[model samples]
Target: MRNIRAIANRELLSLFCSPMGYIVIAFFLALTGVFVIATRSLEPGQPATLRSVFGFMPIMLTIFAPAITMRMLSDEYRTGTIETLMTVPVSDLQVVLGKYFAAFLYYCVMVAGTLIYVLLMLIFGSPDLGSMFTSYIGLLLAGAMFLSVGLFASSLTPNQIVAWVTATIPMILFVFATNWVVSEVDSAPAIREVLQRVNIWKHMELFNRGLLMTESVAFFLATTMLFVFLTIKTVESRRWR
Candidate 1:
């Protein structure tokens, strides 16, 4: 636990020291703000709303979460810090968990940034607080899952660019391709069912509309844990080689 906290603190500090974190936050805020303005219209009678702002988050997260996590283990290995890290008294699992949690926390900040949009909407118009809360909950879970995938990709290679691309490709597939697959396989009920099951877009659809489904929650949790474990295994396997 002590080691985990130390590792998490180090990771968090690294993020604060780096300019990339600030850049990411700025880009998302600007992009989401534009989305809100466009969706709500420029007219004074049509005030801005949180619905459109939150709607942009999943796509933003799909891109930004990889940027935040793609370097987690890969950068350490690239710079030869992995050796020093491995020599520490901490177990590998603790290191992986700590780093994962730190990245997760960073992603949470990204999600929290959208709160400003919610506040703006509240000032302009009535917002459904319950739906807003559930929507943000869904974003949190989605970000966690994406971060876990990025961590696993980082563990697979010492090249950060390669890790980032690898992490991003599957997310793109999950977000875009699965829907296409479902559309194409109209006659194959079983195939469509499977594609829907694998589709992050399908799972996220309900959440975006403020519908809280247990199955979607379970899917996100399972996907996150699966990738986290994969990352732990990837890191552990390197010890033997």
Candidate 2:
């Protein structure tokens, strides 16, 4: 437990110390402010809901999550530090989970900044408290799933760019591709239903409506664990090298 926390702290500090981390977060917030809040949230006489923020988050996460996680294991491999780290007392799973949680923690900080928008809504109008709380729960779960996917991608490649693209493609499919397929094609109701179920963004829609379905929570948790397990296996592969 102590080793895991140490490793997590190390990863978090690296992000806080670097310019790229802050730049990505700033750009993410800028985009969210301009495109989501400015366009829909701050309008007069509109429903005081975080629907716009939650609706826009998956797309932003598809980009931001990859950018944050791209360098985790990939940079270690690039610098030959993975070998040194592997020789330490910590186990492979600890390294992976430590880094995974670090990325998750960083994401939490970024999302926390968006809470200022919630405060803004509070002053301007009556936002549904229950729905807003559930929406944050949904975002955290979805963001964890995104971070896990990015961690798995980083475990696969030594190059950070490859890691980013690998992670982005799956998230894009989850956020956009499935929706487009269901919406554009004149498919049967059954097929569209299946596609909607597969769409990750669709799963979070319930939370925005203040409904915490067990199935949605299970889906995100199971998928996140699956990726984490895959990353552990990938990292373990290096033991033979």
Candidate 3:
């Protein structure tokens, strides 16, 4: 527990100590703001609901999560810090979890900044509190999944750009490939249903409609754990390497 905290703090400080974190945050907010204004002006739905902003998050996360996590292991390897970290009293699991959680938390902060959009919606129109809360829950879960994917990608390479690219590709596939699979398999409703079940878009859509389903929650949690475990394995494999 103590090791995890130490590692988390170290990971977070590394992020804040650099300008990239601020730049990524600023770029995300700017793009999100543009999307909100464009979508709202063209078709002003429920006055100022955060649905539009939150709706855009997966795409943003597809980009931002990779950027944030690109440095997770790659930097340690590049700086010859992995040896020092490995020699520490902490186990591999502890180090992995610490780094993973720290990256996840950072992603959360970026997502949290978008809450200003929710507040803006409240000021202009009456938004459903229950729906809003569920939407946030969905967003948080999705962000966790994204962070895990990015962490796994980071574990595979020592180059941050390579890590970012690897992470971004899978997320892009998840969004587009799922949709494509579903579309091409209309003849196979069972397969289509399964594809949709595995699709983040479907689960996220439920939250957009203000419905919280336990199954969707489970999918995200299970998927996140899968990636986290994969990241752990990837790091541990280095011992044999």
Clashes of each: 0, 0, 1
Q: Which has the higher lDDT value, candidate number 2 or candidate number 3?
A: 2
Q: TM-scores of the models, in the given order? A: 0.93, 0.94, 0.94
Q: Which ten residues in a row are the worst by lDDT in model 2?
A: 35-44
Q: Which stretches of candidate 2 lie over 4 Å from their true place?
A: 184-193
| Cα misplacement distance, residue 84 of candidate 3 (Å) | 1.2
Estimate, for each residue in 151-236, the C-alpha lDDT of model 1 and write its tens digit. Answer: 99999898988898998887876777887888888899998998888777777667767789998999999999999999988888
Over 2-81, each residue of candidate 2 has an lDDT whose tens digit, in order, gives: 88999999999999999988998888888878865565876779888878668878887888888999999999999999
- Name the better of 1 and 2 by TM-score: 2
lDDT of 3 by residue, 98-173 (tens): 9988988887888788778777767666778888899989988998888889888989888999999999987998
Off by over 4 Å in 3: 41-46
Write down the worst ten-residue block by lDDT for model 1. Answer: 41-50
User: Which TM-score value belongs to model 2?
Assistant: 0.94
| Best-performing candidate as measured by lDDT | 2
The lDDT for every candidate, in the order shown, is 0.82, 0.89, 0.84
Per lDDT, what order, best first? 2, 3, 1
